[model samples]
Target: MEVNPNEITNYATKFINILIDYSPKLISAILILFFGLYAIRLVNRVIRKIMLKRNLDPTLTKFLADFLLWALRVLLFVTFISKLGIETSSFVAILGAMGLAVGLSLQGSLSNFAGGMLIILFKPFKLGDTIEAQGVTGTVSEIQIFVTKILTANNQTVFVPNGALSNGNIMNYSMQGQRRADFSFAVSYDTDLKKAKEILLKILNDNPKVLKNPAPAVFVQSLTDSAVIFAVRPWANNTDFGEVSSETLENCKIAFDKEGIRIQPYLQELSKKNS
Candidate 1:
């Protein structure tokens, strides 16, 4: 076998020429890639600061920033590839087709993501809000891209899909700042209606937690076979509602006992009728 030294030298010369011609583009592309990444980070920080200064929701602000960061990175990637003299139209078409395929395969997940975006943009409910939706009542703990985490009264954690939550009816108890506590008490037919109303109203007035603006009321809601049903409605701040109701009930029972306002038992009346 004869060694072809001139052929090997020609190959080496061609390689050097290709490297010399490609070096500028390669170096420039690398620089652009690094600068683009740094710029994306800077932009995200600026946008986040602006959003926070405007008092936007923290969850929403972070989501938007991340979305923007990825979008910019994708664009920079396209630019980097194009700088290398590689065709990008076909590449972008491939990306678009892949995205469409992914979107179709994840229809339900995409719906949830869209719902999350709507929830963030529309401000339906915020973190720590006590809301009732999808037959569940709990305080919102976390707002993610696909699901909302809730802490229920029974200490159970629930993850609710944003798609169903956004489309369904939501009752926000904490939004109004105050809530009305409804109580139904039964008294014997012979009991003094005026005196019962006075006692209930006095109980509400004495409680500092009860709101004074709406004014509490006690009225006969209905007449049952065994007793008269009195409706006691009181208004209080949402935070104080439970305590106010509990204390009011306790005080009312004591007052009723001291004043001889008889609360008849339903079974006792039925037993007497049978006897």
Candidate 2:
């Protein structure tokens, strides 16, 4: 069959007319898309400054900023698609379904993430803080969206789930900037109380790690069934707390031995019975 020239001409004219009808809308949508992306970046910058001013935790700040930017971009894309004469309600529904699926699949992780957000927002414990929680004592090294990394006392690294940490009691030892070094020493009942007190005080004063402002003290804490107990209380910087406590006890013992101050046997009666 011979093709009609008029039919081909009519088809070409119709296609051109369709293009002409859509050109302005397409161009405007494209312009808005580019402008929307630029505006998103600018908004992100402003958000960054605001987060800095608020001193929001860095991990949460970055997560929130990225989430906001991506969410805005998604909405912008849907707007652009709608402007191009495409239906977007289906797109919204699809996104919502996907989010729900993810939320359900990652229920535990989502809980942890929410807990982490609470930790960051409420400021219970921060990075580099020495905190004890969930039966582990460690310094918080990293705070993430789902977990917190801790460097334990024995130099071991622990990854604790934020869900547990946030929900549990956290003892933030470093927050107060100082800690008390508490120790007790027992001497034979026959030992001189004044000499024992002098020896304990000397140990605390000798160590520069022990703070003097709090005025270290050695007092007659109690009289045990077998011996006299003296309590040593000293203040020290939190960072030096362990060292100060250990050194004070060790040195006090040595000093007591040298001074002939008897550290009564813990089981003095048992020793006597055995003898």
Candidate 3:
């Protein structure tokens, strides 16, 4: 069948009229989108500047700025779509459902992320500080969004989930300005208690690393069947806790040996017989 020229012209005219009727709406939507995006960008920039001026962390500042920008853009796009006569309630419902699904799937990770955020905001511990959390003790090397990295005393890197750490007891040793070093030693019953105490006190007093303000405590804590137990407690800087503790023990041994104070061993047989 041959197409009529008049009929083709009529079809073209109808299509052009439809386009003309929708053109203004489409242009208005495009312009709104452009202006909305620009406004979002400007708002994000202002937020970033304020955060910087307030001395916020760079990572947190960037995250907040980006999140705000994306949220604004999405809202703008939704508005633009609604202007073009598209229903957005169903779209919002779909988005909500998807978000709920994702949240359920990532529940553990999201909990950890929230815990990490709390840790950062509350600052229970910071990088390079020695902390004990979730039965693991180490120096915090980094604090991320989901996990905290720790460098153990033995030079091992350990990753602890932030959720467990935040919920558990956290012992931040570095937070204490000073630490106590408790050293105990057992001496033979035959040894003079006064003499042993004097020797230990001299040893501690000679150690320059020990704090002088708190002084040193040396006393007979207990008397067992085989020996008399003496307790020596000294205060030292937190940084030198391990070093001072080890050195104090070593020095006590040397001092006792020089003073002829023999460390009494726990003899089960002798104890049973005495009992």
Off by over 4 Å in 2: 1-20, 53-56, 265-275
Task: Write the candidate numbers in order of decreasing TM-score.
Answer: 1, 2, 3
Residue range 165-186, candidate 3, lDDT tens digits: 8888888878767777665677
Q: What are the per-residue Cα lDDT tens digits for candidate 2 across 35-140?
A: 9999999999999889989987787789899889999998899999998988888988998999999999999999898998889889898889998898888899
Clashing pairs in 1: none
Q: What TM-scores do the predictions have?
A: 0.91, 0.84, 0.78
Q: Model 1, range 79-133, lDDT digits (tens) per residue?
A: 9999999999999999999999999999999999999999998978899898889
Give model 1's TM-score versus the native structure: 0.91
How many clashes would you count in candidate 3?
0
Better of 1 and 2 by TM-score: 1
Best by TM-score: 1
lDDT of each: 0.88, 0.85, 0.83
Consecutive 10-residue window with the lowest summed lDDT within model 3: 266-275
Q: Give Cα distance to truth, residue 44, candidate 2, Å.
A: 0.5
